[model samples]
Target: MTITPLHFVGVSALLFGIGLLVVLTRRNAIGVLMGIELMLNAVNVQLVTFDRVYGPERLDGQLFSLFVITVAAAEAVVGLALILAVYRSRGTVAVDDLHELRG
Candidate 1:
């Protein structure tokens, strides 16, 4: 009935793999952003798991996870805003089409 670090690690690995696949296969900018978010979440899961395993006895894992969630929220907002601007300017959200930025 106890959750182990190994369990959390396995879940994190699965999420990382799925996120990698999404990044590799999707061409839409939004899809890529989602993949990046997924990967970040996976990293957060690992960090919290480690903190729980070895940190002081004050539930630091949950605290760090909260900070990560906050940062992720800000990142998502900024990233979506940028994506919206690009879509408005370029009329497309495809990753391949973003090369127009190259000078």
Candidate 2:
């Protein structure tokens, strides 16, 4: 049988769930950022799939996905910079070790 929208949606859901799990379980800042990126990619997949199925005449979905990618890139850059600064200052990137930010 040919591929379907349902399949794409299921894959997206699975990806999002995996990303969520990663974010919740990781103790490292870089791992959390990777999870966030995965979640963003899942969203982009869903957007493009739906757009392909329902609005093939327009590029709204693709455009939105591109925007999400751009945002994700910016987030990665900023996140990595922050992580680097934090590591330099605290000598670690573990989330649990960042107790200074809780105050």
Who wins the lDDT comparison? Answer: 2
Cα misplacement distance, residue 41 of candidate 1 (Å) = 1.6
| Candidate 1 off by > 4 Å | 1-3
* Total backbone clashes of candidate 2, pairs 3 or more residues apart or in separate chains: 0
Model 2 per-residue lDDT tens digits across residues 4-82: 9999999999999999999999999999999999999999999999889876689889999999999999999999999
Global lDDT scores for all candidate models: 0.89, 0.96
Task: Supply candidate 2's per-residue lDDT for 71.
Answer: 98
**What is the TM-score (0 to 1) of candidate 1?**
0.83
- What would the TM-scores of all predictions be? 0.83, 0.94
Worst 10 residues of 1 by lDDT: 94-103
Error of 2 at 34 (Å): 0.3
